[model samples]
Target: MNTFHLGLIINPLAGLGGTAALKGSDGVAQEALALGAEPRAAERTRIALECLRPVAERVTFLTFPGPMGADLLAQLGFAHQVLGSLENGATCADDTRQAMRLLQEIGCALILFAGGDGTARDICAAAREGQPVLGIPAGVKIHSGVYAISPRAAGELTRRLVEGGLVRLASGEVRDLDEAALRQGKVSARWYGELTVPEEGGFMQHVKQAGMESEELVLVDLADWLRDSWEEGVRYVFGPGSTLHGLAANLSLHTTLLGVDVIENGQVIAHDVTERELFNLVDGYPARLLVTAIGGQGHIIGRGNQQISPRVLRAIGLEHLRVVASKRKLGTLEGRPLLVDSGDPLLDDTFPDAVRVWAGYREELLYPVGWGS
Candidate 1:
């Protein structure tokens, strides 16, 4: 029987423990709940495994115990080998790290981890000695090519690796983003290294480096307009991306690239808001939603940010919404109307109608927020 040796690690609190402005979930007992940072590590683990269902029989899931890693696999019926015995509940980064080290000591061929930048760093530090590595991208700022384009893509790459398919080993850039700067909506970069990443899986994008490129300038200008145009007592719910951060820069506030932020009356009310946080913030205070179109992928909402639930969007109302983007950015989407993925099937009907986007100083284009499939 052909078999492939694979290791797994899930940083249970890795991405879920961020310091969103609403209440820095990081290290805060109460605030973490307030921000609604769902314990996504488990869900991510399940998603990755489900994606690899086709080749499950040929793979061994050498992983941590319980909440640390194995629970997700167990939930999805993965009866592979579990490593690192634990006396108490293993539900943290320390536990995951220990399991990863143990996997290395046993000479596992590849380390597949579910996390954002923090998880990526640990994998680089522990497995850099030519051990193959890949990421599930369960973090907010996953500025790393080591990750597959999505959880499903990550599984596809793993299947190829196990099958000994033409999975060429290429150097995927590992980029870490400053959390502090992330809140301020600016991306600072440092090259981590080229880890052995399998190609042919569209699970990555070249980390968007901070620069004053033409596209960036266009975003900066649009942000300036919103900052200057915003009125007091009005709420501003920010979506993820450099374009959204451009608006934050003008206000001298911070933004998270892959998370949601809420602002009001020239003051930041919240950062890294989840679906629940978004609703509470909107209902408690009237606000406007400012978002940008996803680059290359025609997504206005839902694709990457499944957190923006439809209930929240309905409460905020599209009448008070605004879209910002560069004309070129929209053009790259090539007429594929923006998509919405709010987890609610009804959102497909109530999504904004031909919202006007300020692509340039005077060049305005009406884009359909969602198109019928």
Candidate 2:
């Protein structure tokens, strides 16, 4: 029984921009921190490690020093070796690159890094074709296909890899968006490179697509149904996306293109609300959450609208949840089920076997929802 050597890297600042609604943590990490952004990468990485705990004895971890990777592994009591050195405080791109070089040199079987697009770019720069890698999605803008859908999924994939299961390696895209342009309410994304990703049936994520133009008629039909079905006194919480934005347009209400909004009595009470703000607004009211899936990925909760959150979802109850997707968008999934990675395993399990996706006017499709690995 050969022990699998898994390289681990943690970009401690990956998801700091999410709660702050900074769109992404690249370039504006300092600003996000000043706005009281808390470190989330370590906790997300811990979640992945927790899922891998059952197979702990079959693996030996190789990681960087301190907050980069070693601290979390130490806390989790995993057998690990800290391979490189870094400053005591903030870790940079250079640190990640150096760590990757060292990990590859030491012959790690597979490298598991935790971060967003920037971290993915750094790892790609330092790694070669034959070296397999996977991402633990702990960042704000995760448009890359190299990541597992969630941390728990990452753990499960890693477990399969280490146990010599029939997981196959495939070329996965690395995409980074312009955070500056995103903050200005503009989307600019580009391809950085590709990496070798371990693929299982429904475990890996698909790269995000910018826009889908063919869904216009579908949007109008869905909007018409929503307009007729509007209820009084029940707060309607709209998650981020153009589909929901279309519904807002049809209802003659204003909504942010990429931010959460709350509507009550057919009026926008809260525009561009945060997770905490959303929770506050829906505290005692009967609330219904209206969300749309990612155009190509079919992720309803975890990808962009972390503001909905697992706690918020539990409060809204599964019955109060409404999902909308265009027929064109659903077609992109190719029989794969809709995904939910709310960062809370228990809450994820509470979702019903299948939810109804409003595809058109008075049209609904029962789609299976996938969680866990």
RMSD of each: 22.7, 21.4
Best by TM-score: 2
Best by lDDT: 2
Q: TM-score of the candidate numbered 1?
A: 0.49
Q: Compute the lDDT of residue 95 as modeled in candidate 1.
A: 62
After best superposition, candidate 1 residue 209: deviation in angstroms?
35
lDDT of 1 by residue, 147-241 (tens): 98888888877765554332344667777866656557776777776676656722112112423237666766766666567788888888888
Worst 10 residues of 2 by lDDT: 201-210
TM-score of each prediction: 0.49, 0.54
lDDT of 2 by residue, 1-373 (tens): 3355689999998998999898988877898899999999999999999988887986789998888889999999999998867766678989989999998777665789999988998988998764678899999988999999999999997875554333455679999988888889889999988987777732223222534435677777777788888889999999999989987887789899999999988899999999999988887789999999886677898988999987788788777887887656766776566788899988876675445566677765445567633
**TM-score of predicted structure 2:** 0.54
Candidate 2 achieves a global lDDT of 0.81
Runs in model 2 lying further than 4 Å from the true structure: 201-373
Clashing pairs in model 2, backbone N/Cα/C closer than 3 A: none
Query: What is residue 364's positional error in candidate 1, in angstroms?
Result: 48
